[model samples]
Target: MAGRILIVDDVATNRIVLKVKLMAACYEVLQASGGADAIASARIDQPDLILLDQMMPDMDGIAVCKKLKEDPETARIPVIIITADNDNTSKINALRAGADECMSKPLDELCLLARVRSLLRARDMSEELRLRDSTARELGFAETPASFTPSATIAMIAATPVTAMAWKTALGNTLHDKVVVIKKEQALSLTKTQNIPDVFVIACNLAKPDEGLRLMSELRSRPETRYSAVVMVIPKDANNKSATALDLGASDLMIEGFEPQEMALRIKTQIRRKIQADRLRETVRDGLRMAVIDPLTGLYNRRYAMPHLARIADHAKTSGRTYAVMVLDIDRFKAINDTHGHTIGDIVLQEVATRIKDNLRSVDMVARIGGEEFLVVMPDTHLDEARMAAERLCHVIDDRPVILAGDKGNIAVSLSIGVAMGGLHVDVRDVGQLLESADKALYCAKSDGRNQVTFSRTAA
Candidate 1:
């Protein structure tokens, strides 16, 4: 079926242009001039896809996206943010707002149409799967009970650095597509991140019942993850600890020597008894994943950025150690995006995101919160140190021109970065504010002349 679409933009020209393209593709189209009307139409008309504008007079696109996502009725509807701005910060905000896609403005009609079709297809496919599953369950003979069924999904965390295949034996060796392993240490340390595992599989040997128990207790303590499960593997001889482990709030226990098939059976049995339990576990794990992660870049995002910022702030306050934030901007980004188009713009953003990540230390946090805008949370860095890093990033981006589509030549872009450091006035949330201050400095650099770095303050 041709999908219904909503094009939300304040610009009449852009709206008209989009309408023409969507209509040509046989989509039933709706138009909203700004964010408020868009939300109203979204709830009422329930369009299949929405093309949201980043900057609107009434409400910005990011705010609009968050509002829609917050509303249960409108939440599942996908939003694609369209903007002239191609800075990292703006892109970061869009993803954080749960924007399904981002398009830098001077829109490409073909790209827009293609994206619309793709999203609609995906939405339809998901709905079909859900309905089919429901139908199969109703016809009991046609469906295997979730326990013995290979289809039941369980959220798992392979905290032990073990391969996923091993977890299947107990968790359902059915080879679940969703099963994944994230480093336990990485997940644990990223407390500020949004993505947390549904169930944590800690080595009974490595993470003691005490440590695992503490984490499990904390997971259950949080209203968000209270129902989430924790699976622990203890030595077979450690009979005393199993009771203690369960008491501390572990949902399941595996001994050191569970065969693969046996392990899968245990997991399947759990799935049969309480499907919602698996769901609850997934909800928490997924929420944890979202909690501290920056959705787009896969870098440690806003959620995790807080504690690190505060730690730096604290270190700056107590010790003489200082850190700096470089508000980085892509030079002439709008032009690159305008001339080549947003798909290419997306490629550029990913490249720049990669380059910035590669150039940073493990101690640093790199985030894309906006279109073509980036923030580097540099711990123990002074303005000089931060400036040097900015300079390095600028050179790195400028050093190579990325190859883009449609015979588009290699394009090289420069960066304008603003530097700011911590003192008494800085709060953790002020990282955004600090970034803003640095952005102003970066703007100054751009205004003065592109291809250079500028500090937020003229004086120390």
Candidate 2:
């Protein structure tokens, strides 16, 4: 199913009509007769979205939307206010009441589907972030997002400077957002600017032969501007253009010669949606970072290293190729910490991590498994190649002394590395046992000398 949608209307005919349309789109639909039933169904079913009727005898759609927004469990479900009122005031009121969209009676099926798909796309993204955040919180890896303030910037682009400036003036007078008139050439540069607009209002066919379509495609292709809300404006007669714009990744669309109040309401809704999307994107990034990274040195930590090693083992076994695992220890690391008071010790660890990372292949994995210990996994490697790689890593650490903070002089450092080979013929198929063999070799290297490489007997 694309998603679950709840339809709330006092009239049975309205519910049936919407349900049929939504079901044709392969969405699971739930019906409610009035506001009371709608609230109850939303609370219990937790649908992905709500198609709400504005005028209900028991309670109005605005009040129901407010109640849903207030409840933590239902707050995230998007609401689209469906009504007979075509006035700008009604649209603005619905937006202010936390509805994501407003559509009047005698709805156009094409426009209705476009809005539904866009809102559901936004909803799916938010739900994914929420699930990842929940897992991260359970693992004590979640980060608190910045407190949101109701501020946004919108850039308007049209065929002529006059039209662009008119839009700026109209939107600026009613909305609190920073509205600017942007040209076609300046559209791509917005990504480089510090104050990137939260939403872009594009006039379709602004340039010759539908140049606005090209601009929208360009913005969507670029990483920085891809997530910004794009609303395309088309002439009243260009119904086909509006649908194409939506399919081409426009978040919303408005007809040409639009009402100022209606434009303001739609733009405001787009801004709100963009802010929420931004928050979700950031939260998901933070969660993933925390799950795999070491806080001290910003390297992959043991929690991530073990599972990665197992994957390498599986690949080597399947391909009948050889792989190597190396355990490296910083020689006399505790002495350095004791002598330098831990602060300098931290600096040394960070520098060592950088050096090792810079010297490895992109396919290799290096992780900090202990205070002074690291695990490096290399796939598709032979015994000689593994030994040379280990030697190279040793030189990377010993060739240059790490400079310290506070004008402290550079300090010499060295490493002891132990390498163990694994493949279809190796006795160690389990990553734990492979690591154990490497550890045994590492102990030999440390015992023989502090700054050399040692290979496990299995390498013979």
Candidate 3:
């Protein structure tokens, strides 16, 4: 069943049409004939989704949406404005008033359903992220970052209470909204499950030289929260303190009493740098569009796939980030290619690429390195986790049969896999040696009649 939906329209006919559509989609529907009633229904029901009309007699949709957003109880609920006005002014006004999306009136059910689905999905993701943040604070892994916006995901701890508050304030300034005030001096309680926050701020001014040194030591000790972009803010007269922070592991430092504009400019520059870093990460994982991918299967070529293996291995050795590589061969891929020609072979490759991507975690990367060979790289995975992940991929491939327009009535394919633990060899040896170990395991699988995963047992 669809989530609860609230329909707010001044016109009876409009409300009727929306209610019928929602009900048909299995949504529990609530109706409001005007803005005041809509607000009341919103408070009473706290519906998952709202369809609000732009024009009303007493208060327009923008006014209603703004008031809804201002109230804590209603802020999380998504509001999609349904209006006759399609001009720029109305759209801007609607969004400014906190409407999540807009759909023009004389609504098409298909269009309405699509936008509603997207908004609801976004709402679910946001809620999950927020819950994860709260869980992090409770676990004591890291202190929550000050809200630059309520949606900012970074969490960090500081030695001094005052600087902790300032870091949060700076973080709050990072967001588009200034609505929420993150609390002060909360201890870090993040768990391993929490995603490493995007920004980490360590205020050197918060502690004396000795205490700050100890604090930095404690922070750098944690495995789960260490990958974040960390900033250390120091007072002007503390050379010893700043040096300790740098030595202990801080990414950037800012002196206290910098000009206001200077600080703002520096903060913006840091934000840009962080954003660029994220983009670079995506490019690296997805394989740069221009360089690595085969035009047919969305898989990486020789130029793209091995570099990640090498880079990941190097990162593991130098930064203590963990990694594992899995080499896979499509069993009897040649028979299908022989029977159906290159056209079907290309389709099978695309299907295999899709299977690999769909089965792996978002943190994992899978790339087709050859016509019938695929590679999976998983970062921060230990032996047990990597083995289980490979087993999962095997099952995913076993269960799904490729669907294609082919000369044969139907066809099915299977995969042979090999997984190597990073610490066993890759973390200590070079990337080429690491891949060789996994390839040895893959060769063993094919030797043993294919369709299984084998883990390397090399001594570190």
Best by TM-score: 2
Estimated TM-score for each candidate: 0.37, 0.62, 0.42
**Candidate 2 weakest lDDT stretch, 10 residues:** 127-136
lDDT of 1 by residue, 1-460 (tens): 2677899989898888888888887777899999999999999877878999988999999999999999998887888898889555565567667776676767655445655665675455443333333323333313233444334334444435454446644444354634555554554454424544445555544444455556656666775455444666666656556656655656556666655543444444344323544433343234434544456666555544544555566545543446787778788889988987888888888888888889977557677767787778776566667777888988988888877667867778777777777765676556567767777887888899888888877314
Runs of candidate 1 exceeding 4 Å displacement: 1-288, 291-295, 302-308, 405-408, 424-433, 458-460
lDDT of 2 by residue, 232-307 (tens): 8888767568767877888888778777877888887788778876776676466657677888888888876776
Backbone clashes (count) for model 1: 47
Per-residue alpha-carbon lDDT of candidate 3 for residues 78-191, written as tens digits (9 for 90 to 100): 888888975555655665576765656677676466556655654544443343333233333324343342233544445544545565565444354222212223324556
Task: In model 1, state the lDDT of residue 20.
Answer: 84
lDDT (CA) per prediction? 0.66, 0.84, 0.66
Q: Which ranges of candidate 3 are over 4 A from the true structure? A: 1-287, 406-408, 424-429
Top-lDDT structure, candidate number: 2
